[model samples]
Target: MARVVWHVPVTTSGTGSTTALRLFRLRDGRRCAVGFSSPEALVALLGPDQAHTELGEPALRALTAPLGIDALVVDPRLVAPSVTVPAATQPAAPLAPAPICPAPAVRLQRR
Candidate 1:
């Protein structure tokens, strides 16, 4: 069996090919893809602490940003000293209420 692994960069497109998330099986002489949106759920499906890493910053951000509003997983182009936050996702646990991201994730959905 042949397998390829990927970590979503922005979760929009991926390296070379394999742009979207999917499962594929060789049919006839062709390998075709099937789309699946639940990487986190898939991760769960794969079992605990399987040891994986995400690829492509743009693809990853696109996949995660929308769904993971309150909880963001950033894959920056470069290391950041700090970043800005929106208001919705912020925890009121602080004395000074920090802002959370208001813009909803554009792509991808969370399970």
Candidate 2:
């Protein structure tokens, strides 16, 4: 029996036929491969627009191992709300430059 899991698919440039699995980052900045048990699980966290593919556990591990990603996050939950920026109608004005502060001088005395 195959332990099938859902993974987000990332299309490669140049050759449209080639594709790759999307890797995610952990809270500690470590790269990890994310998978979901079902399509509904994937969509719940990544939204319905996310493209996905079903693969076995071994296959997912084999694909990500070479990329230095040994950690696999399954059915992970979103920690923060997704932020969406509104489109700007007009070009906004540039912000003022930050004020520069001079560092204090330190003198060392040799005994």
Candidate 1 lDDT by residue in tens digits, 41-84 = 43544444433444443454465455432222222122335786
In the predicted model 2, the residue pairs found to clash are: none
State the TM-score for model 2: 0.63
Clashes of each: 18, 0
Where is model 1 more than 4 Å wrong at Cα?
A: 1-39, 57-111
Off by over 4 Å in 2: 7-9, 12-15, 81-111
lDDT of 1: 0.40
Q: How well is each residue in 52-95 modelled by candidate 2, as lDDT tens digits?
A: 88887788889898888899888899887789999989998898
lDDT, candidate 1, at 102: 94
